[model samples]
Target: MRPGIIDRYILRYFLGTYFLVLILILLIAIVFDISEKIEDFITRGATPREIIFDYYLNFIVYYGNMFTSMIVFISTIFFTSMLTNRTEIVAILTGGMSFRRLMVPYFIGTATIALLSMALAHYIIPISNVRRLHFENLYINQNTGERYSDIHRQIKPGHLIYLENYNPDRKSGYRFTYEVFDGQKLLSKLSSDFIRYDTLTGTWRLDNYTIRVIGTDGDKLVIGRQKDTLLEFKPDELSPSLYSVTMMNTPRLLEFIRAERIRGSEKVNMYLIELHQRTAWPFATVILVLIAVSISSQKRRGGMGFNIALGLALCVTYIFFQRVSVVFSTNGNLSPLAALWLPNLLFAIIGAFLYRIAPK
Candidate 1:
């Protein structure tokens, strides 16, 4: 079916205003960001190419996704309020246009933007963040120091793993400890403080080490440690950011959540929150659009000016809730999914109520 003339007009107006407002807000943000980073770039002797291409390009995208809902709400308010104030909306309704039909174009526009934002956030923006964050750390923070060694994090149930000193240049950690436990009782402890791998033997050489084994009957045995042994652990897994929560994608995030739960780790809340929040964020586009349309569509004495103020306040409230919910998630008091999406669920209900009272 062909779209009516009103559909085209509404689509053009909605999308045009959306992009226009997005650009205006992003440009202002970019200007401010550049102003702040300019001194750092100058002091670090960074090239203009590095400053613009390496940093600001990704910086803009990160901020754009972060502020997407605000842009949507503000743009919708500006466009819808303009139509109401100019009497165009009334003219269209009088000319046999139902508000429902008029909303089709706006919804289409928002759906497109929502999908785009989702793809950029999930797939594209993260890759950019890797580079942008690297640039900031390397240049801004002057993090040219040598990478730390002997880094180990607990990976199993009631087990402690340690690395003596890892050499990132060689992708290896020397002198490792892998301990296993049953409840509060230690079942076995493997201590190798001078462990080194022999490329020729494909085995680890542990110098002056002892393996202590505990019996279920409360007995202990000292298993003599050999100068050389073989284990299946790879040093690269212990590298910085390899297992970092931020570096993990959605699947890995789920895997971490599962494994951490089995291990009884308390630090998995942040990862769980990130996983649920990524999925929840896309739906917010629709929620905010509904709220913005309902809030701004009614004609008022002050028109767009007052509507814009209200929209800004509502946007801030929504964002504030989003951040606050993360605190609950991090503290593990609230379910991660609920913590991330509670604001959207509540606002969606409010949006529905407001839409019902919006002008027909």
Candidate 2:
């Protein structure tokens, strides 16, 4: 259906107010952030150009996209509250517009924001995060280490490798062991005192290695001083930084997850949660808009602040659920898909209930 006069008017109000609120909130956020980190910026010799163009530019885009659902809900409640205060909602109702009809422009507006948000979160933001996080690591978090200890990886079907105290910068590890199994039967085992990547030959070199082969009658053993061979994984893959997950685009993230699964990484759930949340959170904007309209369309003696407070509180609850669900996924028995979308499912039910009882 073609959008008529009322739809156009509401679309303009909603989208305009959305950007306006985003700008206002982001300005205040940047101010507070600068106040908090100015000493680091100065001491670390961050040029003004770098701080403004490199850090804060990407910062605004990254964080602004991060809280998009909240921004969208706030925009919806604020605009709808203004209409309620002015009795425009009542007039529209009295003049023959149904509540469902009135929501057309709102949902359309939310779709616009949600699509934009998902595009950024999945593709654009990750690219910018590289620079933004790089700046942060150099200036703000200089002392942090990226060391990983006690690594295990499945190089292929029935083939597993283990290492102790793997270091990324050195591309090496200590006390390495490789085992090949056939079903429950042990096939062969290789042990090494140390393993390091040989950049020139593009192979992993093992020092003082011993290989044990299980035979039908007994066992065979082979010892070597220095040997270079393929190990099917890079050192960094075993110790992927937490920020690395957030900094990957959708396709790379999917590939990374598949690779981690093959490697039998324990943090597979964490990567899955990040991937699922990218899609689920953006789609949640539609449900949030419906809820905002339902609660904020009524005229209240307490005015707009009340609706805004209620909406923010609800958004906070939504975020809390997301956080808790993530913990469950990473540390408990919850699945990634359920963890990422359970809040949306719960709130969608609440929205339907609220819509049923909303002023008609």
Candidate 3:
């Protein structure tokens, strides 16, 4: 359906104000971020060109996606409040247009933003995050190599691997053990004192190892000074930073989650939370817009300032609730889907309540 003059007017105003707010907020954020990290950048000998192209370019997109909901709320409140103060909304409503009809343009504008946000979160931002994280790790804050001690994983069906200690940087482990099982019965086991990946052979070399084969009669044991074996597990699999999950795109993340789940990883909750959050975060744009319009469409004696203050309070509350839910999911027993969607669900109810009481 074609938009009328009023719809076009509102759409133009909303898009214009949204872009203006996005740019202003990003500029302020960039300035503050640069100021905080300038010493590190300079000490690291990071050139200005590298900072702009390599860092800030990704920085803008990453943060812009992060703050899209807040920007939408702020822009909606600002523009809608201005229209209310000028009595434009009153005029439109008096001409027999219901409050719901007036919301059509707002929905259109917000839907566009929401879809873009989802795309970025699910696909684009993860790609940018790779470079951004690399730059930060190299120049800003170095991430220590991930290490695992007393680690165990199901390398494949019925195959288990254990490491007393694993060092990612050296690509070696101490006290490595591999076991094969058949329906809760021990089939065979391999134990090693030290294991290191042989770069030339693309296999792991075990030093001071022993192999035990479990037979119906008894256990057969064999000892050796050194041996080489092929295994499905790799050093990279054993050492993964908490932030590494955020760097994977949707497909890779799903695959990783499946593999981790099969391995019974306790840290899989973090990855599941991230996967749910990528989709949940974008729908917040629509919810916040509903809320902003409901709160700001009515003119009051305190005018735009009153509406803006209220909007800011609600936005802050939304962000706080979101963070709290994430904490619950990550640290507590809350399911990732429920934890991530709780804020959206709660605010959606609030939006509906406010819309019912909002001025027509």
**For each candidate, how many residue pairs have backbone atoms clashing (under 3 Å)?**
1, 0, 0
- The digit string of per-residue lDDT tens for model 3 on 244-285 reads 887899999999989987776777888888899888988989
What TM-score quantifies how close candidate 2 is to the native fold? 0.92
TM-score of 1: 0.80
- TM-score, one value per model: 0.80, 0.92, 0.93
lDDT of 1 at 129: 74
- Candidate 2 lDDT at 93 equals 92
Which RMSD values do the candidates have, in order? 4.9, 2.4, 2.2
Shift of residue 139 alpha carbon in model 2, Å: 2.1
Which predicted model would earn the best TM-score? 3
Q: Which is the better candidate, 1 or 3, if ranked by TM-score?
A: 3
> For residues 1-360, what per-residue lDDT tens digits would candidate 2 score against the true structure?
233999999999999999999999999999999999999999889999999888999999998988888888999999999999999999999888898999999999999899999999899989999999989988988664456778999878899989887877788889999999999899999999999998888899999999999999999999999998987677677677658998999999999999889989988998898898888989999999999999999988789999999999999999999899889889999999999989899999989998999999
Q: Give the C-alpha lDDT of model 2.
A: 0.91
Pairs of colliding residues, candidate 3: none
Top of the candidates by lDDT: 2
**Which of candidates 1 and 2 is the stronger one according to TM-score?**
2
Clashing pairs in 1: 150-166
